[model samples]
Target: MPAGPLRGTIRVPGDKSISHRAVMLGALAIGETRVTGLLEGEDVMATAAAMRQMGAGAAKHADGWRIHGVGVGGLLQPAMALEMGNSGTSTRLLMGLLASHAITAAFTGDASLSRRPMGRVIEPLSRIGASFTPSPGGTLPLMMTGAPVPVPIEYRLPVASAQVKSAVLLAGLNTAGITTVIEPVATRDHSERMLRGFGAELEVEELDGERIIRVRGEADLTPQTIEVPGDPSSAAFFIVAATLIEGSDLTIENVGLNPTRAGLIDVLRQMGASIEELNAREVGGEPVADLRVRHAALSCIAVDPALAPSMIDEFPVLFVAAALAQGRTVTRGLDELRVKESDRLAVMAAALTAAGARVEETADGLIIDGTGGEPLRGTANARVKTHLDHRIAMSLAIAGLASQAGVEIDDTRPIDTSFPGFIPLIEGLRHSS
Candidate 1:
């Protein structure tokens, strides 16, 4: 993984979360919705395909992806099961889309995704009058029948899950009344923000330390032209890589800096990473910025548990950053990581350990002893297992670049689930250097 300092300006793919919601919402709108800068990742593509299968017109043009939606409550029952490759986000959010429509659909996915718990979405969606027949473990390969006469109810999230919250709110869109989601802990607000952008009557208010998000039912969604900002989660890999490798000064352009999704930047800055926001501005109703990250001496700090939701997807890479910091890094309140495409906490712990990082796996989080800014010894002759997780693959790839011996990953194909051109992007930086 030895290399000279990384130097370049790059724009990662569009935000996956926002892209997924855009496709879903566009498919449910009344007219043609155009989306530029849409993420073409496998996960987001799955949502598009599912929407197409349910009588929506989804096509990619030279400019961007375009969607001709079936109006609200106009979804057709799919003739075949919806195949969600490795995207839990797609599966969960699409489940919500199906909940209030008068459509019956079956959801299937890859082995990693099939193992993930869908019960979180299932319980609340069922309360909104959707009928679900989940597998034995409450995982995928599930069958769902959307409510013929949906009911609107207020649901309080038992855990901090944006997916679950999104599912309930989406179901409310086709029901007769308001669907309320009470979040004791906030997750990403992309769903709420995009819902409002599409003309859904949604409002958010905070009361007594909890967030109350309500969406009016039977929404008349208007078509929109959306420009998805660059994915901060995707850009996180380069940010960490640049910070860990000496002499690196890299700038990532048009990155989404949504407060709920920008916690990684805050934590990294607190750990003494030199990340500067240049040309901070707004794009598509979300905060956007170009980030200039330079190599810096890093000191590990205890990660606050409360910040997990905002940067949940970036923790694998953050673990890699922590593994190379000056001291031990402790993280907790990440049990949610256990239910992602893979067991991220365990997989990252084992992968880094194989590459010579001192790591202790905990029930909820990990304890990583950094190399004190030195290159990892790498796996020597062994390969790190990705477990079909995109973040695990990319995070270890970054680790490899800072390793004495290049890290070998068992599979990097999973990267296409989110960051499609990751290898090419890294190679471009290497060649440019």
Candidate 2:
């Protein structure tokens, strides 16, 4: 089973971040908003279901989908707990949505999501008249009481989390006055963009070095038809796989090149991976274009700490690529990885080392001494542990394509979250062999 060139025009799934926000803001807006090309992954789908639990009626239409909004400040109390399956995005953002309303809601998720700490969000949102009865350690299975005319406060994020920022902002929508949140490190701005798109009075200001986002209460939203661009994150695995596979040439179409999320592309190019941008254009305020990635001799480069937020979800795959490159790649400011779907940084370091890649793990990030563009000589039989993470599983599978010994992922089920067509898409690329 040799790695093959992936040559085709692949339309990746809808942007996960944008898709999550679209469904959520649509549910909060009044009238009908038709959303085409929504990410139907488990995470985004969980958001759709969460919206319905909160008095939002969203139904599928002929060509697009329609959501009858509950209007800002008009959400009814849900009768039962909101069950978010395997989606941290759905759970965290919904907590914020649940916070500002005068409703009591409980939220729960799968075991993987339950372990993630909710205290970061709970601490800030609780100030705005909301109260929570979270499991010990502020983990999930959270019972929330949304504040009526919630108090708007200035919150400083302990860490750089787009989810926490969006949560506070969403809760701010129901607050009586402006709610301000400051982040020293900027995360993805999808929620902020989509909020304004829905006609909310949101103001973003930079002070000192942080992004201070203030939103005026009680939004009057206009219906919108969002054309979601292809997901760049989902495209990352294929790009790395194709580039690592000798004689490979692949073109990924219509990928969202949001400045906040294109770090993976930049890093790949810096590592001497041949990636080109084509048909550059803007869609719904985000720059999008086709990506052409080709096989090339590779060398690793030390990553800038600033790029972490943009490519946070891509570190695992990037690690795989770095292991196959010519020089050492050092990464820093990645403390955020400790609490993701799995302990990504540590877990990936262990897995890469297990498969004959030299990796040094740190509290915040990793330093990988590469194999100098050599295919990893994996152990006699190594089953890469995915730890129930989609990205990790996909990355290991891609490694199999290029490693001396093909890789096996523990479970590939989670790949459906973003890239439902992953295996088949890669298999189809066999023609390029």
Candidate 3:
């Protein structure tokens, strides 16, 4: 059965990265901070809850959300463990924030998050005097005691990870000196951008293709109003959906076009996607734009490894797009995908294969043989295993739109973590079509 093309303009939820930072930074500012267009997803809510647990007054308002800060070095020890839910951003960044505050904090998460490693942050933060007693393999369900007298250090990221970088920076907030992070490959700079917006003395320099970010310690952050732009990662599903379904024409509004997070658009265009940027503007220190996308004949191309950091979160859906394109698509330098909410590379390979696509899982990436614009022969009983990963659940849902039998997902609950209204949004677009 063929599905109709998608139409209508849709605004995705606020950028998850920005939303998480807003809550975290707002709680650290000296006064009240008001935020509009904050994502009310579960992950962000978990951050809000954790802030409240640490003595910040975070509450929902009629227009948006509000946070009363605890100021620098003023966080209270939580009465119990911080329940981080499924947000790795919340857990890792909070670990950094707590690392130098002289507070003992215990952090725990759901089963999926507990399985993911926290060693990357634990190791770097421990060097700054933070001590952790983590579950084996440096996984979650751990306790961290902040350094009474924190010492700053210049650290180079072994892996390109925004969470790791942000963790180190956040930990440096109350340390005695400047903390610097040198990235071999630039990751998302939401923490840096938002930190500066909150009045932290931070500097960024590019030397020999590496980004050096430094933040001064014991800086006071001033509260300000923030209006988070729409999340481009969430918009990606519809972008690929419209590009794959013939006769489709759609527009996504208020999407953050931050250079660090817009690699998907570039990569999709490289694969022959028809996407236009309209009414470009700036929002909350990030670029914002409306995107007009249409159906196009796609050709698979070998993706550059350097593009991984910018589009890391969008790979699952990108893989879905590749499965319907012409020729073969090869992706490399994506070992990071294996440690996400799920083993995205292996899960996507299994899911797409179950849906009748030829996908070969690689050690670090995937090789996909495209169907040359043909619909997948999805069986009614072919349930895609979501493994509690929101991206995987949503990506497979989009694949269902172009499947003859309409794909079924093992779980849609995880979608609430990022895009709570995803199914309703898809249904509305389908009805409009």
Per-residue C-alpha lDDT of model 3 across residues 1-433, encoded as one tens digit per residue: 7579998888999999999999999999999999999999999999999999999988998988999998989899899999999999999999999999999989999999999999999999999999999999998899999999999999999999999999999999999889999999999999999999999999999999999999999989999899999999999999999999989999999999999999999999999999999999987789999999999988999999999999999999999999999999999999999999999999999999998898999999999999999998875865778899999989998888988998899889999999989999999999888
For residues 1-433, what per-residue lDDT tens digits would candidate 2 score against the true structure?
4565667677778899998888888888888888888888888888898789888877778897788888888888888888887899898888898888989999998898899999988998889889999998898899999887689899988888999999999998888788898989888998888998889999998888889999998778777888899988888988888788888888899999988899999888877889999999998877899998888877988899999999999999999898888888899999889899999998898778877789999999999988887888774565778899888888877777877877776789988876788898788787645
| Candidate 3: residue 203 lDDT (0-100) | 99
**Which residue ranges in model 2 land beyond 4 Å of their true spot?**
none
lDDT of 1 by residue, 1-433 (tens): 4778999899999999999999999999989999999999999999999999999999999988899999888888899999999999999988898888878899999999989999989999888888999889998899999988888999999999999999899889999889999999999999999999999999999999999999999899999999999999999999999999999999999999999999999999999999999999987789999999999988999999999999999999999999889998999999999888889999999999999899999999999988898899988788888998999999999999989998999998999999999999999998898
* True-vs-predicted CA distance for residue 5, candidate 1, Å: 0.9
Worst 10 residues of 3 by lDDT: 377-386
How far out, in Å, is residue 430 in model 3? 0.5
True-structure RMSD for candidate 1: 0.9
User: Against the hidden reference, what TM-scores do the models get?
Assistant: 0.99, 0.97, 0.99
Candidates sorted by TM-score, best first = 3, 1, 2
